[model samples]
Each structure stands twice: as C-alpha cells, then as structure tokens.
Target: MEPMLPEESRFETGLVEVVGGYAELPSGWTVDTPDARDRFDVSRLTRLLRDHERHGRGWPGSGVDDVLVEVSDTGERMRANVVVRDGDEEIRAWGSVHDRAGGRMLFVHIVDRDLPDDVAKVCSDVLFHWAEGQAVAVGSARGLEVQQIDTGAFEDDARQHDWLEGAGFDRVRSWWQMKRPVTPDEATLVPSTDKWESEGVRVRLVGRGADGMPDHDDLRDVHDVLEQAFRDHFNSREETFDEFVHRLREDPGHRWDHWWLAELLDVPDAPQPVGALVATEVSSATGPNGSYVSYIGVLGDARGRGVAKSLLSTVIADAAGRGRDRVTLEVDADSPTGADGLYVGMGWETSYVTESWHRDVPVTGTPRQQG
Candidate 1:
C-alpha cells in the first residue's frame, strides 16, 4: 500500500528451514564454511531466511522456491539448506534441497561466485554434500536410491561450471530471460471489457480497505486463483498465503493500485475472483521507473475468457501511463501452455538466456524422522 525503500543488500549467513518449504539437511554433515562469520544463532538464521525470502532478493518469491524458479508462488515443498558466507558475512554461496511434488523429483539449487579460492571451494562443497545426503534420504523414503542430483549455474560462468562438474552436476538446458520495450501504444492496447461484460467477468483493480491497505480477502482470492492456475505448470508449489502476501510486499515499488483481481462478477453472494495480476513499479537507480508483472494467474475455469490478456494489457497500459522505460517478466521455456507465445504476441522479445542444469546423486537410506 505504501511505497517501500529498497533495502541495503546484506549477507544472511546461516541455515534455515521455512514452514512447509524447508527441508532440513541430513545429520552428520557439519555446518562448515572456512573464514566465515559465525553470525548464525537460530534467531538470526530465522530472520535471514524470512528477510531473504520475503524481500532481500529484489524479486518476488515465496520461501525457498524463489531463488531457483523464474516465476513462483510458494506451496508445500519441504526445503532446507545453508548459505556459505565470507568473513564480511556476505553470501559466497547458497543451496537448497527439496522434495518436489510435481514430479516427485529430489531437487537442488546451488550457486556461488566471486569468493576467495578456498571459500569458493567451501561454497561448492556445502551444496554438493547437502544435496548428496538429501538424495539418499529421498531414495530411502521412496524405496529406491536417487538416480540424479540437479543443480544450475548461469550459462557463461565458466568457473561455476567447473565447480558443478567437480561436484558431479551436469549441464541440462537453457532458459531464456526475456525483456520487451513498452511503448504508450502497446501499453494502451488493453482489451476493453465490452466483449466480456456480458460474460459476467470483470477485471478491476483490487479494492482498498478503509484502513487503506489492500482488501486482503480479495488478495487471498488472488493467491487462490494463482495456486489453481499453476497446478498444471512446471514446479508448481502451494505457497502459503502469508508467503504470497509478504513476498509481493517486498519490492520497493509495490503499489496497491497495481494489483488487479478478476472475478466472475455476476456470480452471486460474495464474488470470488477467478483471476489475478499483481503488477509493481520497477525502480531504477537511473532512468524512468519500469513495471513488472509479479504474478498473473487465472483459474482453469476462467481461461479463454480473456482474463490473462486483460491483466497483461492493464500492466502495459499502466507502465505506459507512468512513462516507464520498459516492462519485463520471465517465462519457463518448458511451460505447458506455450505461455511465451502469448507474451511474444504482446511484443515481448528474448534478451538473454539462463540455463537449468541437473544430475542424479546416490543416496543411502536412513530411518525417517517423526514430525
């Protein structure tokens, strides 16, 4: 509701396991990072993950999934991992272990860079070792050993590739990171409601509360819509309502006005929206502000009713109205809906590519821990 200041980036040096998302690293693996700060009491660790997850990253994400995926709303994914830090307490490396529901894949995301040689090695070691233990635990639970352990690095980071190969991760595939120039004409091209007025669907800016915050009930509906919408998409996870709200608020340019909720309006008692788009202002150190589509979700029932198009149009138009330089978003190269086609149709073009690399790791079974 209120404009937020960009937080100074700081290192959150420790380990954390989020509510439904954190999967604890297996026992017998020491918390080890050479020449690093011991700033990690449990309290500090808790705040670090929450802050890093909800805001620190300069992007939208829920819990652990934020760092690994291009677009995400958190859901039930058991996640746990550690961030290796330096003497200055900045991140040298970070990694996660997760039991993925969509494909029942035991997943890992490990990344590090720009650290002293030994520290860099420690960073890589932390990720590989944790992932190995996690793979074993998953295999034991599923009655088989894990066949692979997956990890990723930027496409051209030769050093990181060397680390991954040394750690036994393999190169998988590349994902495109696209950007598009937004002009007044493109932004203003939002579809009129005239066509959908009779269909009982209306997309409108989220109503504000008397206290001047977003009407959270509608906000929750937006999350619900997105949760339902992404059910068939890759890496779809059930992000907690709290995670959804907090993560969206993390961006400095978050605005209540930019959030839109689309409802099957004619449907009675209390109209529940079947679609939502959470858009935000993108602040630049220089140049005009830009716009971002934080999330665009439409219930399965609402697809083909023009809900997504309307939401996209509104974001572009809003960006143009504010005289922004451009608009941007990420798309999964493996999306089931061919979502990129829609963005391409709307004039977005690929500006760069990111890769997803993966490999199988062996795991030994251990007795399960009770909840």
Candidate 2:
C-alpha cells in the first residue's frame, strides 16, 4: 500500500480541493487533517458516536486502536480523514474515506450527539460532501468513470438513515450482527491433530513458510476460494488479490495464525482448497476477549459437503483453545444461502442489526482527472 500523494501536499491541499461540491464550513468551525496527536480527542468522539448508536443495541463499540488506524497517516495508506472542530475547539465531527478497491469507496461519517439538530445536520452535510469529493478523486485515480460510495448505519439509527438518504444514498441491504458463546469444553470440538478431517474434507491453519510469512500458494488458494464463492452474493465486486490482502491487513485485530483453509482430499488429483476462513482477535477492557470471523467462504461445489461447517467449527474450537469467551460474525439477513439460519443453528444469536447504503458518484473530466 502507498500513500495517495506526497506527505507534504496531502493534508495542506486536502480532499475537498480535489473535486467539486465542497461544503462551506460554518463561522468559527474548522476542518483539518488528523494526526497521531489527535487520537485522544478523535477516539473520544468515536466513543461518543458509538454510544449514540448503542442506545438500543448491544453491539461492542470500537476500541481506541480502531480509531487510531483511521486518523494516523502512517496507519492506513489508502485512507484519508478529517475532523471538524467547533468554535470551542472541540472535535464535533469526523469523516474518513477508504479507497476500498477499484470503483468502490467506504465512508465513515460521525457527528457529536449533543449538537443541536440543525448544527448536526449541517455537519452531516459537510461530511457527505467531503465524501463525494473523495470518491471522485478515488475514482479518477483508478481510471474509473464512476465510483460507488458505500456506507453503513445501524438499522435503528433514524438520524443516520436520514443523513444517508439525504446524501443520495439508498438503503441496499440488512445484516445480522451475530455472536456465539465459546465454552472451554468446546476446545475438543476439533480433532487434536493440527489438521481435522471428516468425510473427505480436511481443515487446518494456513501454513507458514521458513521466512515466517504465510505460504503464498496457501494464501492464493484462500483468496481464490473466497472470490469465487462470493461472486453471486449481494453487491459482490471483483477485488484484486493485492487489494484484498492489503485491506484485510489494515484491520487492527489482524493476525496471521487466524487464517484457515479447507481442502478436499477425496479427489483423484492433488488436494485443493474448497473453503477458507479468516478471523481476528477482539480485545475487551471489561471482560474476556473474543474472536471475530472476518471472512468465511466455501466453494459452491463444496457447500453441501459440510465445508462451511467444518471451517466454522475449526474457528470455534480455536477460539476456545485460546480462552476467548465468544466468537462474533455478521451475515446477510437475505443471503441466498440462508447463512443467517446456519449461524443460528450453530448457537449464534443476533445482537444487533445494520443496513448498507450506497450512492454511485460519476467521475467526469475534473481538473485533476484532466491533468
């Protein structure tokens, strides 16, 4: 991953100057680039925003590390972030944009909960306008005619829904945020051996090479399996192998040992991967830590053969072995595969719900693009 531009100019010029539709800041309010020194204030703002979202939901809020990753310039190369401060010099709003992949961008819009409705609305507009400009810049850089700005809101957050809709985004899909408890006894759920086998499917952690990096072939197999498996899923898009790897590594909880691959051994030829699961460690300040399943995909040909189940069981058992108290994951509420049902059957319960919103912004011959 590389910085979008040189260090000296990235913050001074900022994203708003890259395209049209710049939002005018109110009197005495200022928007500026965030750095590591702002982590305390920014994280406090994030916690405030998360607290507002948690009014009716029990979703675990983000940690300071999560907020730091977005604010720190050296943390994520493909991301740009800015904070809005009131006249009192308090950070009232924060906006972040991630060049997620070709033709798609991810936006995070947050405003202080205690602001007056009118002021908060204005802040929302400012963030959305900034996001649109960033999207255009990202699209032009990728040589794309249009870029889809994708964002999410808790299903019950009326304020967020209104803001997103007002910004030309449409409610696209719902997701079930699920969690399942892990018991120490479940550590025996998988075979004691490093590789667990059942009915011709074998599950094991991705191998590490002598250099301590993951085996390239194993990683490629995981990427291929996931890419093919999600092709027909909602809002699926083609992500290059490099982009996929880079994006996942940006997560604060990312760990190499949490990656797993499942292979079919019954075939006549050499065994090939048919399923993959990537997990991350979630920390907790009030209770025991947890494991989060970031990605789980089983090839279409191996779906009915229990590849999904095997991969999931491996994760649960691994979590238990690591003394994690629970495992969490999110599934599409309307998945064609009935993934929600499978998760429920495995003892996962919905803790909260979220919806995806999308707005496609067209990229034309802007001055930046022309140059």
Candidate 3:
C-alpha cells in the first residue's frame, strides 16, 4: 500500500516489459510501444470495458470514471497496447501488469470486454507471456522458477471467466463489491457516540494534512489498528508504517478531514486510540461525487461492543454530510468475521461479483536462498 520510489516503480514495469517481450505473442499486440498515448485511447479502452460489463455481466455503467495510462515515447516504462479489430469496431485494451512487491506472483489487470472471442483469446495469450517474463525476473530475485499470472473477472461473465480458465487460470476465490446510497434521512442510523463518550472514547476527525502532508502519528495509528483488525482476516499482511503513510498520501483524491481516529479509554487515567476509518473522495466530472471507505478497523479488544458499527455509522453520516451520493467497499466472500453480513445489514447491496483467477509462476530453477 505504499508508493515505491521512482526507480522501484520503473523496476516493476521494466521487468514486465523486458522479460515478457521474449515470448511470441499473438498478432496485433505491442509491448512497451508508442501507443497508449492520450485520453482518447483510455476512453476507448474504458468504453469497451463498460460495454462488456454491462452486456456480459449485467452491470451497467463504468466502475472506472477514467483510465490514465503511461503516455510517453521515451520507452522508459512498460506500456502495452493491443488493438483488436472486429469489422469496424476497434476493441482497444492496455494492460499495466505488476508483480506483487516482496512477492513472486505477477498481477495482470485488463479492463476490456465484448471483443471477438478470437481477439479476446489473443489478449489472454499476450498477458500470460508478459506475466511469465515478470515471473522469471522475480524468480531471479530469489532463485525461483516460474511466476504466477494472477487476474480477475466478474463471476457472471461466463465468457471471460471461461476464457481465463482455458488460458490455464483457475478461480481461486471470489468477492462482493458492495455499494450503498447515502440518503439524508439515514442520519438516524448514526448511533449516538454517547456510549463511547461515557466509556471515555474520543471520536474525532484526524488532524490536518498540513496542505496534504498529514501527521504521521495519526496515520501510523490507523495502520496499527487496521493491521490488528485484519490480522485474523483472510490473507492479511502487515504493511510497514512508512508504506501506510505514502500509500494513502499518494492518492490525489486523499483528504485529511476524511480520516477519522477513535480513541478508547479502557482506564479512567489512560485513553487508548484503538480504531480508525480512512476515506477518500471519489469524483465524477459528469456524475454525482461519492465517498469510498478505503479502510476501517478497530482493535480486537474493541470488537462486538458497537465499535465497528459506530465507525460505519460515522463514515456513512460523514459521506452524507460531504454531499456524497453513495459509499462503496469490498468484502472478502470467505471472511471469517461476518463482514459481508454486517455490510448487508447496513444496507450495502451487491453491485457485482468478481472472481480471482490465480496461476502460480512456475519457477523452473532452484529457490534462491536469502543471504
């Protein structure tokens, strides 16, 4: 969740391009090419994705308000551009694949749909080669063999799902992308902070960003809370505090006031800050603006006593106060905690179902021992 330094960023992209380019991919695909230049290309890519999801998955409208791709001819980064022509329709797609930092698997994300089956197959082939190269590069890091190409598509889109399956990927997991509209009337749902008040919990907005430079203590506290809250969740990983600060701040839409910290006073003499909820502004130049719950967490000791619910209530109410039309978040389908149930109880509806397709990077060589 942290921003890698500029050199590190290039390393990720460069590995994908330098290594992935070795394979004989399908025709009409270019890697690290002169294409993927401007907003027009991104628009075409988004329109294809939106149309595909609408028809194939029955989800209307575009989840992505915009798509900003790397647009430079200096050839310093990986910019993959694929244009599949079916009659007069041009199904344009661009993939920006990344290998998980400190991990081996390569993540290939493509927002494309409704292309001719042949064209779609070609895109998958191209992505697999790209991922394979990335895997080898990563393997060289630790003397591993092949790397896995990880991808996801909507669960409902059988065509896309089947294509990925045939392309040697498996549905390893699934998730629910939920959204709830914020109505002014729902202000009643915001539980009074009275109970917490009597218990000596301090609930208030986190300090200012100092013109986008927020206090690190509050931010780190949030990371601590989240790390603790999700420690038992599925596939949880501990993110360093530095990564936490840089990751959130890296988002242009990040707002300081949108971050809220809650402190619990277990002892009359000692007040402990045990929870945090982070939000970011979701803007739409053509539609109503929205708010997204980037992260929300409460310490393990604080659970089951209205702490989580209060956090949700506070965020929902805050979104309404900020004039946001809706709030969105994703929950693991196999969450041990009844997270999906809780969101549903709070009026969040399933907007779509996405499946995680995973294929391990096959390291043909011996594992590299850490020095």
Candidate 4:
C-alpha cells in the first residue's frame, strides 16, 4: 500500500517511536502509517481478513469510508494505525488502536493468515506488544491506573483465540449476531400517525429541528436513556454526551431518520423518555440494503411496559417503508436481562457468533511526553 505523501496523522509520534517493539521486527521488514489514499488497499485487506475468518462467507466486508474513519484523525477520540511491510513492500500485518472511551481502549490486530506459522507468530507478538504500550499511553493520559484492551474474534477462528490467549487476553464474552427479515407489507407495521403505541408506551422517530439537526433535548434524551439502561450491563462505561454523538456520527451508515425514541404515557407526571433505538443502513453489494440496530435501550424503570418491543417494531416498520430487506442486531448471549430471548421471540435468528477478548494493562511509570 502506498503511504500518502505529506501525511497527516493524529498519532503521537514521540510516544510511538519510544514504544518497545520496533526493534523486534526482522531486518527486511518495516513499519509504516497509512493515510487517505491507502483506504482502498486497507479495505481490501480487511475484506480478505474477514473472509478468511469466516471460512469464505462471501461477505462484502468494510468499504472505503469505514477504513477512512479509522485511518483519519478528525474524530473526537485519538486512534493510530501501523502496517508491517515485507522487503517487497507488501503489507503483511496491520494494527490499529483507538482510545474509545475513558479506561477502555480498542485494538484491531490483523496479520496476513497466509503466512507461515513462524512468520505469523512473530507479527502477532509484535503487534500485541505495541498495543500494550499504546494502551498504557492512553490510560496514563486519562489519569487512569489501568486500561482495558478490548478486541474480538470470530467464534470459530481458533488462530485468533490462540493469539489473544498468548497475549494475556481472556475470552470474556460471546455475542449473537442476529438478523430479522422485513416484508413489504410490514411497512404498515407502524401506524399512519408515524408512531407505535401499546400499553401506555409510545415510540416515534426523533424529531429534527429547523437546522436539520436532531432536536437538542430529544438527542440528550436518547443519550440519557441509553446510558442509564446500560449502566449495569457488561463492560458499561460512562461516555459524555459529546463523546456519544461524535462516535455515532463517525459511522458511515448513520442516518438521522433511523433514530427513534420511546416515551411512557398515562403516567402521573409528564411523558418521559423510556427507550431509544438508533439504527443504520446496511448496504449489500447485491440485493437490497438492510437496517441495523446499533443501539436499542429501555430504561430500568420502564422494563415490562413493552417499551423495548415498541421501539424495535418502529425500526422494522421504518425499514420496510424504505424497501429494505432486513434488520440486524447483536445481543449478549449471557445478558442478565435475557435480551437474547427477547430478540428470538421477536423473529431474530442468530446468523453468526463473535467473542470478546480483553486484557487489562496497568499504567505504570511516567506518561508519554507530548512533542
């Protein structure tokens, strides 16, 4: 892959250079940073990686914009990427790190699976070590004593399981990647009033303001509803409103029309936001695109009032109205709320499985100096 000339990177150069693993690279191998022009090659690499992991699932994988978000530096959080190239200058391994939120860091470790075992092991070791250093830097910057390094792998990919285990990461959780098909007739699934109401719960799309942005109060309501809903869930973290909006907008599939909020009525007080469903478009290389529920949350106070179901039904109806094919979502297999059961009862079926592997690295000694 060709690096962009006069490159712009948000990566802390001083911190990266001082990281301990570069010397471990073989003499003929080198490390490089990718920029906008490299998105195609990087995206191709991503597609190949996914295909290999899924045993030739034939999925289209990520597009250029997905790679652009990771390789670009315009978002709220800081992220860095490194590609390992052989003497022929072809990329054999790629590692990207993101300071996702306070105390949590995300790592994407991809090494060419076609390489010999020894070569692959070496590349994996180097990338894992480098990720550890990056995690420390991120944690220290946040005045945190330790940072969680979160990464994922396909359930059947034993190679990834081995690499992550070798790097001290534990298989912490499993997720069900579920999908539900939509029919054209379902477009009328939502009432003509553009809302769904049942048992004192009402769901509707978040209203837009005169400026075309979502109403500020409504947006905050969505954020607050989700935060409180997931507060006790696994891996829960406190993300500020600014961070929440910035992260969601970074998605290439984000659409203002896909956002829906739920309210509880017939209560003693004024209507209150009890649930929210944030969805996105899932473009397919062939056939109609689908909708994906990025987040669907209902507050604890409204649990049994059918708020969650109403919000989900609204998205499915919205997707049908758009002539979409399906709706997809991920649910924790071991959720205390029995969310998987809810999805299964609502017509969703598990299409695949993925596992979360994590390692907590302690932030010790001095923080990386800024240049």
Candidate 5:
C-alpha cells in the first residue's frame, strides 16, 4: 500500500485529508489520532463525548464527504491519518472550533503523543501549514478579516511549544484550576440566609418539584442576571437566549440542586436579580470527592455588594450539606473583575496553572515568519 494525497495515491493519512473537494474517514474510526486515543483516559473521553452527545455540540462536520486512507506495506496496517474539508472551516483543522456566526475559529484541543518519529515530524509540519491555509481560505470566503486558533492544554512540553512557536503561534494567557474543601460550615459562610437580612437582598435556592426539574421562571431569572453581570467581562460574547439555555442544559455536570439565585430586596419591581451561581455535582467514580462548581458569575451592579461572597458561601454550604468533600473551579488569572480575590477570600487555592495560546488570524493574516 502507498501513501496518497487528495490528487495522488489511493489513500492518504495524517490529521486531515481532502479528496475531490470532499473529506472522508474510515468506518468505525474517528478523526481522533491513535495516540490521542491512548493518551486520553477512555473513561474521561466516554464522559466528555457522552456529554457532547447529550448536548448536541459534538456532531462531526458535514463537509467531510471525501474519504482517504493510508495502508502499510502489509496492506493491513495503518500508520497515520488526516480528515479534510470537514465543511466547518474552523473545525476542519482542530482545537475548540466555535462558530461566531460571522466567521469561525479552530481550537486544536490535543495531539497524539505516541506518533511515530517520522509521522510526528510530518504532522508538526502539516499542522502549521494547514493552519495558515485554513486562515487564507476563511479570509477569502466571508471576507473574514480575522481568524483565531487556540492551542489547548499545552503543559511543560517544550517539543509541543517549539512546534507551535515554529508554526507562528504565541502564548497569551494562563488559567488556573483551583479546588477547595466543602465543609458543612462553609455553607454557613455563604450568607444566603443572613447576608440578605443585613444587606436587604433577597436570596433563594430554587428547588426541584415533583417533576424533578427546576422552575423555568427561576432558571430564566438566573440566566438574565448572569448574562447582564458578565456582559463587560473578557470574551464577553453576547449569547442569545437559546444559546444560554443550550449551554446550561448541555453541561454534563448540570444538576437542578446545584443552582442558586439572588435578588435585591430594594428593587422589588425593577427586575433586579443581582447575583447567581451555577454549580454541579461530579460524583467521584475514582473515589468519594464531593461536588464542584463548574462555573460561577455575579452581575456587575451586584459586585462589591457581597453578592459574590454570599453566592459562594451558599454553594459551599449546599455542597457540604449534601456530603460533598470538595468544590473546584477555574479562574482566569487576569480577570478584570477581581474574581480571584473573592475566591481566595473564600479559601479557594490554586492547584495548577494552564496557559491559553491564541493566534489572532484576522488581525495578523499571514503566520508570523519564524525567527
């Protein structure tokens, strides 16, 4: 068997391949490389994919109609693979592809670590070139003046960093994954019960009814509060009502019991839901760790009003009440809102730091020429 390109050979291999303007892949096989398959724990992948499937965000691209494969000398062995023309230009490459409606960006999530020396080297070369090519294609299609690609989860790997550097990508920001113990007493600290009394804020924990679902009105109120609160924050993308609903319902960790809502008592008629928190319980399959906060947000008007502190106290208390051992959340190190200070005050500490690499495709058209 011989290696094939879109115009040559009967087969092709690598991360992506295009044939006659169509992109295709083998049956029972996915675009994920073999090494990726091994590196990501199967169970974690199962959960993540299951979450994606449940949420409808993990669908494969439609443009990948063309198929290509590479076979070894024995005709039965396969070495490398690539899928191309996956319809979604942003997704065609890799990373966390987000369709911004006007244009798209690709976020290459991970790379296979077990790639053969030759295959790995080739992949590195192709990844950079392909990224550049995709940018040009997008730029031509929609007059998309800009393109951005996120290099996901690169940690301490000089080789990977070198490849990205060689490819013209730059490191931008770092994210921290922090965890904290959730004791029954922590719930008392949330102040949902008392902060409201002192500050004249009305807070309530929306509960599930006989139907086992939270009240829609309450949920909508919380969404509005969060949407307004985060409007001016970094990456403050305006999300439609449907988008917000989709995001909430899609969370794999979403549980009705884990959400909270707060309103200002003084603004009874003003639609003042000043604060809200969304949390979920991740039952430890590996052990007995407690629930965690996947996300938390406070409205701008509600900031410095103790709304954030109250919300955290409430969440921690609730987690502790339910016998959870720990609560965890991720924070942007450079949050303009000073959320890090709030978390620290609440006893949350950083465990690990992860960097975010972004290549602004539109602002800078061509890849940064290697130095």
Candidate 6:
C-alpha cells in the first residue's frame, strides 16, 4: 500500500463523510476502494463497525462529521475521525473512511501491526486521541454530542484486536456473509396449497397494468401492511405512506415485478391486506444475479397464518417467471422472533452473518436515550 498524500488528510465530526481525497493514518494501515457499495456491501461494513465498537475496539467518532480518506502502504487515502464524551464511563468512539465512485466503494483497512507493548500503546493512544478530538470538534460545530464511533473490520486480524484493546476497545460480535446458487429446480418449487387453507385467509398474485404500475389501492394497502408489520422491529422508525413510497422509488434497483402482497380473508366484507414483500432485480457488472428481497412484512394479526411463507413462495414464483436465477434477502440474526429459522425453513441458507454493536446515549431534549 502506498502512503497517503498530505492533501487528503482533512477531518470533520457529525455527519457521515461522503467524500475525501486520500491520506494515510499511521503506519501499517491501509484504506482503499471496495468493489461496490450495494446493499450487501454496506451491510457488511455496518456489521464490522458495530462489532468492533461493542468489544471496545471502537470509540465514537463525530457521528456524520468524520472525514473519509483513502489509505495505503506506499501512500494511503481514507476517511478518519475521533470522538469524545465529557462524563461517560466507557470510552466510546468509531472512525471509518470510505470512497464510493461509479457504484464501487473503497474502505480504509486498519490492523495493529505487531509492535512491542509500549509502542502499540502509544499508537493506540494516538489513534484514540485523534478520534476523541474529532468528536469534540464535531460536537462544537454541530451542537450535538459525540456519543458513538463506527468503523469496519478486516477478517481475523490478531494485531488489530490487540491494538483495539490497547486503545480501550473490545470485541463485540461476528457477522457472516452467505450466498446460495439459484437452481432451476429450486426456482420451480413454489409452495403449493390447493388444499391448504387458513381459517380466514386467501392469497393471490397482484398484477400490474401494462404501464408498469400497480393499482393505487393495492399499493396503499401494501404500504399499510408493511408499516404495521415492522412497528416493533429493530432499528425501525415508523414510516409514513409518502416516506415508504419515496424510499422504494429512490432505490437504484427498484422494479415492479418483485413486489408482492397478501390479503386476509378473515374480514368478510372487505378483505384487508395482511402481508407484503418487495424485491428487486439487482443488476451488477460484477456478476449476474437475480432478485433480492428489499422488504417483507406480515401484520401482527396475521402471524402464524403461514402468511410469511406464502409471501415468500410468491416471490420465488415471480423470480422464476422472470427467469431470475436466485432470490436473496437479509434478516436480523438476533431477532427474538427467530425469523432466521423461517427463512432457513424456506430453503434460504446463511451465507454470512452481520453483527451490530450499539451504545445508547441520551439526547438533550428527549427523555429517552438514542442508539
């Protein structure tokens, strides 16, 4: 890895760093571009940062104010930052610098090179101090507390762990990345239930008009079902109808075919939409893969009616109809509901695990703490 040039070393605090030229941090640390920043890639980065933070290898940087630089051996460039808290018991901070261009993302990779204990401590202290200073700067500029730091991980680096511990950081959790090939037979195996029926449930495929649009009423129902279904899930923020619609439309991979909905027949007079699944055909120059489920939800009242299974089957059928090779989706591994088991039962295998580490801090005006 080349050394980072001097010009790329700018820093910030509160907002996520969107761009930075390139620069090196200290010795033996390299940050560079990643192949892409697709959903899976970003998910991996989140996992690394969270795990490191939980274990004490991470300190809170200036939330979104950190700078991203690209770092390398001969010369390095990547984002960098430090965070500080006035009266917290734990040392909390995180720093990560990545570059995204033309759909590809490059991240700075750091590892604590095998140094003597004394030298390692000094280096760790320097990095941690830098992170703390950055956080303070961000708080001063943005008038917000620098509570958490986020960074990524390189697989199984002992030296990295040592350095993090030396810097007052610890290990958190491990995440996995998994994938399965979509076979022709697998695609054809849609759940059949000609005779299977719930007391008051009915399932049907939704059709979009030639203009590539779903019925306004149906779309609204789908959105409603989703909002209700995820009300209690992790990291969930209640989304308004407009916000939901905007998010889907804003996705680069959004497509009409991957959308699905399930209606509850329990309501005799007017059938209510109880479940919904939205998927997308992700096109990547890196490889040829088919549909990925962006979202899936089943309302509280519709649980255990096999609604989720049915919705997933519908997606598989649709993917096959479109000649898509495989279907992909993500789940919160630690969900109390054991949703991962449901996906596994439906033939989805764990390709990888992504972990999250969080530290909660109280916000100024709000009585509750924010993670």
TM-score of every prediction relative to native = 0.62, 0.91, 0.78, 0.91, 0.65, 0.53
**CA lDDT for candidate 2:** 0.80
- lDDT (CA) per prediction: 0.58, 0.80, 0.62, 0.79, 0.53, 0.49
Alpha carbon lDDT at 248, candidate 2? 78
lDDT for 239 in candidate 6 is: 49
Native RMSD of candidate 6 (Å)? 12.1
Error of 4 at 315 (Å): 0.8
Query: In model 2, which regions exceed 4 Å deviation?
Result: 1-26, 56-60, 366-371
- Model 5 spans > 4 angstroms off: 1-106, 124-144, 185-198, 206-210, 268-271, 362-371
| Residue pairs in collision within model 4 | none
* Per-residue lDDT of candidate 2, residues 1-371 (tens digit): 23233232111135447433434556788776666675568667667557666653655467777877777655445788777778877788888887666677888888887889988988788788788877777777666798899998888888888888888999999999899999999999999425888889999888898877888778889899999999999988888787688677778899889999999998837897999999999998888889999999998888789988888998999899998999999999999998887899999999888899999999765434321
- Predictions: Cα RMSD each: 9.4, 3.1, 4.7, 4.6, 12.2, 12.1
Clashes in candidate 1: how many? 16
Backbone collisions counted per model: 16, 0, 10, 0, 26, 72
The worst-scoring run of ten residues by lDDT in candidate 1 lies at 4-13
| lDDT measured at residue 183 in model 2 versus the true structure, 0 to 100 | 98
lDDT of 1 at 275: 83
lDDT (tens digit, per residue) of candidate 5 on 151-234 = 544355566667777667778777777888876666566445323444766667765568777777777787777778777765
**Stretches of candidate 6 exceeding 4 Å from the true structure:** 1-180, 185-211, 214-217, 284-287, 361-371
lDDT of 5 at 284: 62
Which 10-residue span in candidate 3 carries the lowest summed lDDT? 72-81
